[model samples]
Target: MKDLFDYCDFGDLKLNSRIVRTGLWESQREKSGNMTPDIYNRYENIAASGVGLIITELYSLYPRDTFSKYSNTIHYTQFVREARDLTDLVHVYDVPIFAQLGFVQYNKKTQQNMKIEDVTIDDIRKIQTDMIIAAQKFDFGGFDGIQLGLGNYYFLSRFINPNFNTRDDKYGGNTFNRLRIVLEMIKVIKDNTKLHINCRLNAFDGTTNGMTLTETIEIAKLLEKYGADFLQITLPRSPQFFTRENKEENPLIEATEQIIDNVNIPVILGGGANSQNQINEMLNSTNIDFISMQRPFVKDPSFLVDWQIKGNGESFCKTCNNCYWKKTATCHLRSCNP
Candidate 1:
């Protein structure tokens, strides 16, 4: 069986290993939402540490979507120029970078910050067109690929989310209907750019009556049909579906298996996969294609190279949720949940 260090190619980009520096909200950016040299240095450090792919913490596709007073938002020409510098830096270490696109109208942390009004058919079409335009801009700017945060439901998630989406319209009814927006959005972008597009699906929404496994698999199927290069599967800590209780109990492995069983495309699972033993098992399963964890990266971004070389199983992280809390507290540094 191949270990986590094995390479996996997704489109034109070739990963030297399957170990992705998962999208942990590092808060390493400046308060103005620009990449500080420290964040750049962190990327450099991770690349030098030998991570196969460094998917960034969420970067807003539009400046208005930036909720973090200090996160690195990529909705500006200035940000685009600086992003090229960061990617160039990553390439120097022979590591690839995938900038995660973000938008969160159903943002639990800052619902008050966002305004949500259901759209008419005409309005929906225009919004979709705007999203396509935005994607084109980001692709032309020279990023390798775009990771759609659809699973977390910036807008599409809300539409699919039972708690937030209450519309009777075609865009917000059943699970299949809710996914249409993201599918169309991805399709339009794929139609225009050769750049790889990855779609994230919520394995569990973390709510009481939120998203279920069946619906989640359906979402992944839609992504596959749309020609998504990868399916980024994650658990959403929602108020109605996935909950804090089960998120701790279930972990990502079991959830990843069910998702991988449904989709033929490569499936990427992240969130609390803090050890190499689990990562190796994921690779050996022949079901899961990638083991992506965020918090462990926050604890020690270079831990991947260490584990890859050592081939040990114990977790390097202290199980700290600081990366999540720091974002809530508006702190640039991780909360250090240990």
Candidate 2:
């Protein structure tokens, strides 16, 4: 039986455990995305907590768009330095880390009100270059690989989804065409660095018009072709599901199984997978090579450590989705409000 603490060779990276930490926003950093002592302490604590791998939250490729609200800007070099410190600290524990690169949309406010750039090919190229630059820096700073948030509100996802992407060109079309931008971006990163890269794909858009299992499987094939060492699949329901109050299967794990069958590279299952029994089932299935946990750890970084020590898991993941609606930050690193 493979224990959570067991180290495994994943792609080109050596992960210390099968239980990998997914990216969760650590507002612990300064508003400008600069490394803060609190954030550093948090990483040290998590790394020390017996985790095999920790994937940092999405760092904006464009320093000007670091904050979700698009109000503050992070310093590129300073953020890199702080990121390096976190990497070095974690490496002492023999854990591998990955830095996620993303470009956030500016709804209204941005430094000096810089005009929101359209999704032009030039914009995509520049963003890809920035990610490559970040990857080289991360490798030098002691990170194992780089991952892209390909199908969400971040730039790549924004460009993929019809909801966020409205342009009608080669970059926009039926699913494969939409994937062109994402694949090209990955190629550039690989061309620039010798590190492994992970690209996470949402299993479902939870909408009638967005991603379906079919679309995701097709996307996964392309991801592997373009150089994704591993594919992390997650399912996120839209607000419409909450409004309709419909409760059926989330289809995340099921979709992951399909992706596993279709792709040759390692496939990871994440989202709502926190329990011991659930984790065992996923690992036992032989369909998934690894599992990623974001909410579970964000709620309680100590959960895994405690689970190993005392068989207790009291995490702060409310899963209420109120953090977006109430407009107030809810999961500020601690919450048992479930």
Best by TM-score: 1
C-alpha TM-score for every candidate: 0.83, 0.81
Model 1 spans with C-alpha error above 4 angstroms: 62-66, 106-117, 206-209, 238-251, 313-315, 328-338
Worst lDDT run of 10 residues, candidate 2, spans 107-116
lDDT of 2 by residue, 6-81 (tens): 6777776677667888664545556555666766776777788877778877666554454444221234557556
Per-prediction CA RMSD (Å): 4.3, 4.3
lDDT of each: 0.67, 0.65
RMSD of 1: 4.3
In TM-score terms, candidate 1 sits at 0.83
Q: Candidate 1, after superposition: displacement of residue 91 in Å?
A: 2.0
Q: Worst ten-residue run, lDDT, model 1?
A: 328-337
